[model samples]
Target chain A: MLKANNKVLVTISAIVLFFLIAPLIMVIITAFGTDATIAFPIHGFTLHWFANVFAQPDFVAGFKMSLIIALAASLLALVIGVPLVYALTRYNVHHQAWFQTLFLSPTFIPEIVIGFALYQGLVITVQLPLLLTLLIGHFLLCLPYVVRLVTASMVLMDEHIEEAAWVYGSSRLKAFLTVTIPNIRASLVAAFMLCFINSFNNIPISLFLNGPDLSMLPTAILNYLQNNYDPTVSAISVLLMLFTAAMMLLVEKGLGLKALNEM
Target chain B: MKNRSAFLLLLPGVLAICLFLFFPLLQTIWPTLGGSGYSHFLHSGYNRNVLGRTLLIAVITTALALGLGLPLALWIARQKASVKSLLSVVILFPILTNAVVRNFTWIIILGKDGVLNKVLLGLHLTQHPVTLLYTNAAIVIGSVYLFLPIMVTSLIGSVDELNIEVEEAAAVLGAKPWTTLTKVIIPQLTTGILTGSILVFAGAMTAYTTPQLLGGNRHLVMSTLIYQQAMTLGDWNQASVVAVVLIIMTVIVMGLMRLVTRWLDRRPANA
Candidate 1:
């Protein structure tokens, strides 16, 4: 009975896997099609779409801009998030629960509302540059993930190790650097990678904050699809998936995929 | 001095959050309350409709996601290790893909002469192509597809952690399978269910791309209306007012969730 049940589950899982992966596979194949319009069972294949993706200045520029924005936002989130996690773990701060909930409130709010609010605040109140507004929005979105992972790592750690370091007459900063940072290195890396991917994939904020000059990759793809539903959009999507998968693998190598799964 | 150092450690994050998230929310409220001496947003005709539709869709989507996800999660939780991992990755793939892309695929499948219609007509199940696109049904279908992975993952997480010996003991005591599930298993999963429902509710309330693409211009959720007022109509005041109202509603819902979870935690174990 158990063996029969296992066989049934495996079959169901296979079907689910096929449904999930089919669109992605179709996208990649369509990207390589020689025909202008997307069709299944391609007549011929070439690397022409890849060439087109590279040759287009807009695509290159958008990819570069997105890379910069994602990197900057993730780094900023880490810089701000690491200390908050440390404080939450190491000290009995006032209203710690309130602070944690406040930090996480942005994630609960809809992206479009955040985008609109930021637009109004920036253009009307602060009059900051579009790039800066986009950065702020992305950072706010990524902050919760960083704090969550870092705090989880802190909780899992043995408190005695840090106390032992302090007993050796190590200063607080030195103790943190030598003890806490080393223990949570894997979580830190995982948090940074996830933040980077999320910032890169963000669309709603980019849509509201992007000016004539600053266009992120997702926004660019959205515009291209809206105006012209072609295989180039598919090409872009395939590239994005490959890039994200590669980055995830790199992080897994550095840390472990197990840690990410825990989050 | 020690307190100062700790405060300094928290300063950057607290300030960033305040300036970016909380301050905008504060700024939004002021505009709504006639901070600039303009009470233009006092009327609630269109705002009420948007709020009602947003809540309606959110409730329906949450129901559908739980309905599909609970069974799949229960089934998967009973599986072996390798099968579990493979199924997890399969379920998570749609979540990994861009939301816009997923909605667009649904569009292709649900279009007038699309795959579903083609299949139905070819099989003579229907003589005519069904009008599936640009409707509330399409929006719900897309949302359930998008959010099912989250619900399943949450349910699976809770179900996996449950001690099976309790259920087995109940069965040995002559309890039926259904009775064992309801009495022995479900109470333990209240925390998980509450957390998962809140997460789903929040996501559904804020969902933009799926509804926008599938529901067409005829449909208007709060988020879409906010976008229209700010971006399309160039009415910042009205947009701010609407955004403020939505934010307040979200906070109230979150608070209610916290209260319920607290109450559940406080209840006696035997009760």
Candidate 2:
């Protein structure tokens, strides 16, 4: 009876796991379909849709914009987050929990709320330019990831090493630069991956914050999807999956999948 | 001096978050405080329907995710290390991919002449290609799919910490497996269940792409309603009211979950 129960559990799990991946697998398979509109049991295979995805100006531009925004947002987040996390972990700051909560608050707030809030505050009220507003939105989204991952790594490392470096006549900056940073390198990479992916794949923020001239990749794909129901979207999705897979490999090499699980 | 130094370190990031994030959040909530927006929202049957549907979908999504996620967590927890990592990679794929890309695939699978209808017709299960996409059920499926990773990841940690001996002890003490699951194993999983439910609930409630793509314009959830009000209708006041409603819903759910988890935690001690 116990063994039978185990079998049942395994079967249920397999089905659930399949459900998680089935959409992605379908997207990959349909990318090569010769049909004008996407359908199953594809009549013939072709690389035609792959080339067709590039023919669209909006997608190419959106891809470029998304790359720039993700890169800038992740890099800026790291610069601000590393120092903030280091201090929070290392210092005797008052209301440290409040500060930590403030920094990490973005993760808890729904993205639509954050996006709409920023749109109202920045775009409407402050009158910031669209690109700057977009940058700010993406940066807010990225900050929580950096704080969580880096803090986890920093908390685990021995503070004594940095203190020891200080005792050996090293400046605070020098000790932090050499001793503290090298220890948390894995997490930095992991944090960057998380930040980059979140910013890149984000929809709500892009949806609210973007102007007519500005478009993120996901939003552009959404625009395309609204008008067209073709295999070109499947092609774009397959490329995105491949891009994510490459990033996953890089993270695995740099940090490992364990760091991702912790997130 | 230490505090001063810490403040200096925090200054840049804090200023950015406060000026941009928190300030905007306040702005989003500020209008609703004036009473007009809430009165307008409360008066509108359409607005109330969207709010009701969002909450209902969120609840159903959380429950379904827990049902599906608990078993997957247990299965993954019992796997070998290498196999565990492999499964983790597979699970992580959806979490990492673009939401639009992910939802788009569902559009393909659930479309009129899509994979699902085709299969159903081929098997003589249906006489016609049923409209599956842009329905309430499709939104639920997509929401559960979008947030299941969060649910599974949260539960896996709790499941790993669960002692197998406890369940065995219950079984040996004249309890059936079902009783052990409900009484022993489930109690142990309270933390995971609470955390997972809250995350999944918040995610499903605020989700835009899944509902926008799968539910389409006809089936509007709060998130999509906010989009329509703000972007399409260009009414920031109405949008902010909806946004505030969403924030309140999430906060209440989270607070209630914490209380329930606490009650569950203390139940055995009381007994």
Candidate number achieving the greatest TM-score relative to the actual structure: 2
True contacts kept of 2: 0.77
Error of 1 at A73 (Å): 1.0
Provide C-alpha RMSD values for all models, in order. Answer: 3.1, 2.2
lDDT of each: 0.76, 0.88
Q: Is the docking of candidate 1 incorrect, acceptable, medium or high quality?
A: acceptable
User: Candidate 1: deviation at residue A242, Å?
Assistant: 2.0
- Give the alpha carbon lDDT tens digit for every residue of A1-263 in model 1: 11214454446545544544665676667677787865544568777777777876767888899899889999999999999889888888888898888777777677878888787776568898888989999998889989999999999999899999999999889999999899998889888888887788777777688778888877776666667755676677778777866775686578755555554
Residue A5 miss distance in model 2 (angstroms): 6.6
Residue A111's lDDT within candidate 1 is: 81
Candidate with maximal lDDT:
2
Superposed Cα deviation of residue B256, candidate 2 (Å)? 4.2
DockQ of each: 0.42, 0.66
